[model samples]
Every structure is written in C-alpha cells, then in structure tokens.
Target: MKKNINITEEDRKIAAFAALAIVIHVLESSFPSPFPGIKPGLANIITLLVLFRYGWRFAAWVSLLRVTAGSLLLGTFMSPTFFLSLSGALASLLAMLLLWSSIRPWVGMAGISILASISHVMAQLLVAWWLFIPHRGILALTPILIATGIFFGLFNAIIASSIEKRLTDTV
Candidate 1:
C-alpha cells in the first residue's frame, strides 16, 4: 500500500493560491473605482495562474472564494450586488476554462484572463439590466462599462502573463 503524505505539494499550492486570490481581491476592492464594478482585476491573475499551474478545479475554487469573501467583506452580502458578482465570477471561470483549452500554454494566461474579464463584465451588465435597474440611464452606462472592461481586461492579461512567466520558471 502507498503511504499518504499528511501534507502534499498540491495542498500547499492550493492554499497559497487561495490566499493570494483573497489578498488580491481585497486590495483591488480597497482602491477607489471610478465606477462601481470596475477594478484592475488583480485577483483574476491568481485565477489565471491556478488555471495554468493546477487546472480548472483550482481556478474555480479561487474564483468562488474571491467572490464570496469579497462580497462579505465589502458588505454587499445577500444583495443584488452579491448575486451579480457571483454570476460574473462563475461566468469568468467558465470563460477561463474555454480560453485555456483553446489557446497555447505560452499565451494561455493572457488569453484566459482577457476572455474571463470580458465574460464577467457582460454577466454583470446583464444582471444589472434585468434584475436591478431597467432604466435607460442604467443601460446607457453599458458602452462606458464595456470600454472600461476592455481596458482593465487587457491590463489584467498583461499582469497575468507576467506572473505566469515569473512563477512558472520558479515553480
């Protein structure tokens, strides 16, 4: 029989990844945003990292923790914002899986990050349009939000790519 190690390398990787995700989420949330939902998406870097290093399962865990803890700490618990964030996070994770599968490993981090960010923004907008605000004013912000989404998405992609390069060589 094979002996089971009490602390596996994979366990350490998972804990480190989750902690990094939470820290990034908190940092991003702390910074002031011009708009309600816009952030540098620093946390998504961890998602991309996990997707690249471990797999989709780890990536999904990162996303789930990021959103759940983010909402609770930001005091958006049980609100429409919570639901919207949850939807966006899940959509982003799904997009990451899709992009990761389709792209090469060399650029997988950037591709997955960008696609996930776009997916998250779209999900948030859809949730806002349908559930919270159905007014013209809310819809009017779509173009601006979309533009910001692209900008922040690309920013996160670059960061994720950098992190992937830096860490992959070491780990």
Candidate 2:
C-alpha cells in the first residue's frame, strides 16, 4: 500500500511538471517575435530542472506532455508546426539526458546547454524537411535557429542551475 501510494505521488509530480511546462510554453509563445519560431523556449527550463531532479524518463515525459498540450491549446493540433515542436523538444530532452548521465559531470552546464541547443535545432530542421519542406528549403533558417536555440538554452541552464541551488539549500 505504501509503495502504491508513493507511485501515485510520483505520477502526480510528473503531471504537475508537465502542466507547468505547458504553461511556460504558452506564455513564452505570447511574447512577440520578429520572426516565427524564435520562441524563448521558457518551458525548456522545466526540462533542465527535471533532468537534474528525476532523470531522463521524467524529463522526456514532461517534454512530451508540454509539446502535446501546448500544441492543442495553441491551435496547432496535428499540424506541421506541432510535429516540429515535438521533435525539437524530444531531441533537446534526449540530449539533456545524455549529458546529465554521461558528460555533464565532466563538461558541466554550459556544455550541456550548447549540445542540447544544437540537438533541438537539428531536430526541428529534420522535422521541417521531412514534413513541410521536402525540397529542403527550410534549411535556410538553420543558422538563425541554431543561434537562437543556443541563447535560449543558456538562459534555461542559468534558471535551472539557480533553482536547483535554491531547492538544494532549502532541503
């Protein structure tokens, strides 16, 4: 009974994290961008936090929920944009998981952020090429997207690091 209770609590935590991620995603999207797809990716902060706190499985679940819920709410639904966002989030989460498990101890947060950013951009590019622009014309956005992803990744890393520090100290 105690074990089952603990499992329920864990499930609740995952759901709560995913809800927060979705909220962040929506709020970030509300911020006006001069160009499309230049989102701040504020929800990614959640992913980083989950990676440090719970590991890859939880982080991946949060990422998946955030993208799906965010897309549904944002009216993208099953559109190309939704798929692109999903792909990017998955790639970023996977990269964070890999780094946290293997390279993060040696390379640190900055390296993780850079790698995750690159993975996100690449994932979006691949999705775009496969889904929307088979002619590969969306490749033009790669450079700028990569730069933006890196900047946002660094921002998320800072936020995650600070939060982790605060939580650790309090606990």
Candidate 3:
C-alpha cells in the first residue's frame, strides 16, 4: 500500500516565505560587493523571522529553499557557489536548531541570529578552503568573516524583530 502524505495550509505559508527569501537572495546578488564574501545576508532576515513566528521546521524549509532556488536562479547550480550556499544554510539551520531547542527561553532573536550567522560563515569558509583554495591562507580570513557575521547577524535580527513587531501589531 502506498502511504499518503497530507499537505496543509501551513505548507503554503512556508512556500510563500521561501519565495520571498529567494527573491531577496537574488536581489542581493545583483549588487556588487567591494570585496568577496562580505555580503550582509539580509535574506536571512526572513528565515529568522519565520523561526521566531512559526518554528524551526518552517524556517528550515524557507532557508533551504532560498539557497537551492537562489543558486539555480543565479545559474550557479551544482557549482562551487551552490555548494557554499548549501553548506552555509545547513550549518545555520543546525546552529539555530540547537540554540532554539535548548536555550530558547533564555535567549532571544539576537542571540540565535548571531550564533547562526557565525555558523553559516564558518561553514562557508571551511567549504571554500577545502573545496577551492585548499591553502592555509584561507584561515587568515576567519577573524574578518566572523566579525562580519556578528555585525550582519545583529543588523538582520533587528530588522526581523521590527518586522515581527509590525506584523503582530496588525494582527
């Protein structure tokens, strides 16, 4: 017998969030960065918001969808960029899951966002070093990347929090 899976309205909501994330990702990609690997990661704001509002599952769906669809849309599917994006999303998801599951009551959006952001950057850096560069020089960028992650993570968390407040007010 074939097992049936039920799709609910929540699935549609998650898909909508994922689409928004993908759009944001693509738009962010259009801008030129003065340096490589210095993106603000604003698209992650949607994921962080969804995680705070819905749950980790919804947030994971949105984040992974954004990375996969965004990579495909950018014509980077199965390329180095795709791998890096996937690694970062997966790492961030893992970090968020751990933090949200254990210390959720104690920690807030800023804490989770900062940890996830650092995890994402670390994963991407490791992937880049292992797959592309394969040199000790890759380690030199760790401090800079981590600092950027912290800054952007806080910034994105603030944006997400503001959006959430507005949404709650309307509802």
Candidate 4:
C-alpha cells in the first residue's frame, strides 16, 4: 500500500534547516573536546534561530532531526551516546516550549538559550548517571557542566541574534 504524503513549503523549510543543523552536528562531533562530554554545541545555534523565526514546532523538528540523523551518521545510533543526545535535545525542547508559552514576551534569546542549555546538560548528566555510570562521582561534574552551559548558551544566543538581525535586514 502506497500513500501519498503532501509536503508543504513549511515542510521543505524544516528539512532544509534540519540538514544545516545535521551538518553542523557532524562537523562539531569531529572536533576535539577539552573534556569527555563537552562541546560548544554549535549546531544548537540553528535550532535557536529556527525557534525564534519559525516558532517552537519548527525548531523542535529541526533539533530532533539533527540529533537522530547526526547520530546515525556518526554510527552512534541506539548507543548510550545516542540516548544521551536524545535526552538532552528533548530536555532543551521542553525548556524552549515552556519559555515560549509562558514568558515569551518577557524573555529574550539569551535567557531562553541559557535555560535550554542548562536543561540539556542536566538531562544528559542524569541519564548518564542513572543508566551507565551509576556512580556519585558522575554528579561531581554538575558545576562544570552548568558553567559551560551558561557560557555557551550566551555565546550561541549572541551569534543567533546577530544572524537574526542580518536575516531581517536582508528581508
């Protein structure tokens, strides 16, 4: 049985954005991290931009697609690493949804980004501790992870905002 699926312009936009994010994810994965579980998460900039421009739904699609596809490409699918990535992405998406629904007008990109990033790190750490490590020492990385989340979140926000401005100006 074959069913025809109608693809809308919005669907195309989401695919395009997701592809961009996937590329960034793959590239970032190739870089050497200073720590075992730390990266700048440059791909998240695309997710943040899509969120601000197209709304949370589109951003969610792009982000999830990026994680799934990137994991497959990296040969990490169905691995613990994949689960960790999915958990972090899901956590980040939830944070974005909460902010977008409740205090969107009051919060700016920086606040949203920081909160989402922190949520991502926390979710990953929890998953790692519960599923894999099962050690109290895993939680010891909390402070460092949170601090990096704040720094990278703000950094990504600044870049996202700049890109948004350019996009708006050109439009």
The residue-by-residue lDDT of candidate 2 on 32-101, one tens digit each, is: 9998878777787787788668878888888899999999999997988888887888888788777777
lDDT of 2: 0.82
Residue 17, candidate 3: how far off, in angstroms?
0.3
Better of 1 and 4 by lDDT: 4
TM-score of each: 0.83, 0.87, 0.94, 0.97
Better of 3 and 4 by TM-score: 4
Instruction: Point to the candidate with the largest TM-score.
Output: 4
C-alpha RMSD between model 2 and the true structure: 3.2
Report the C-alpha lDDT of model 4 over 98-152, residue by residue, as the tens digit. Answer: 9999999999899999999999999999999999999999999999999999999
Better candidate by TM-score, 1 or 3: 3
Total clashes for model 3: 0
Query: What lDDT does each candidate get?
Result: 0.78, 0.82, 0.93, 0.95
Candidate 1, which segments miss by more than 4 Å at Cα?
1-9, 103-107, 168-171
Residue lDDT tens for model 3, 1-171: 999888888888888889999999999999999879899999999999999989999999999999988998999999999999999999999999999999899998899999999999999999999999999999899999999999999999999999998885222
Worst 10 residues of 2 by lDDT: 1-10
Candidates ranked, most accurate by lDDT first: 4, 3, 2, 1
Superposition TM-score, candidate 2 onto the true structure: 0.87
Local error of candidate 2 at 120, Å? Answer: 1.0
The sequence of per-residue lDDT tens digits that candidate 1 reaches over residues 1-171 is 999779887777777777888788877777998767777778887887777777888888878977887778888878997899899998898887776666655565555666677788888888888888886677677777677777777887788778777774546
Which 10-residue window of candidate 3 scores lowest in summed lDDT?
162-171
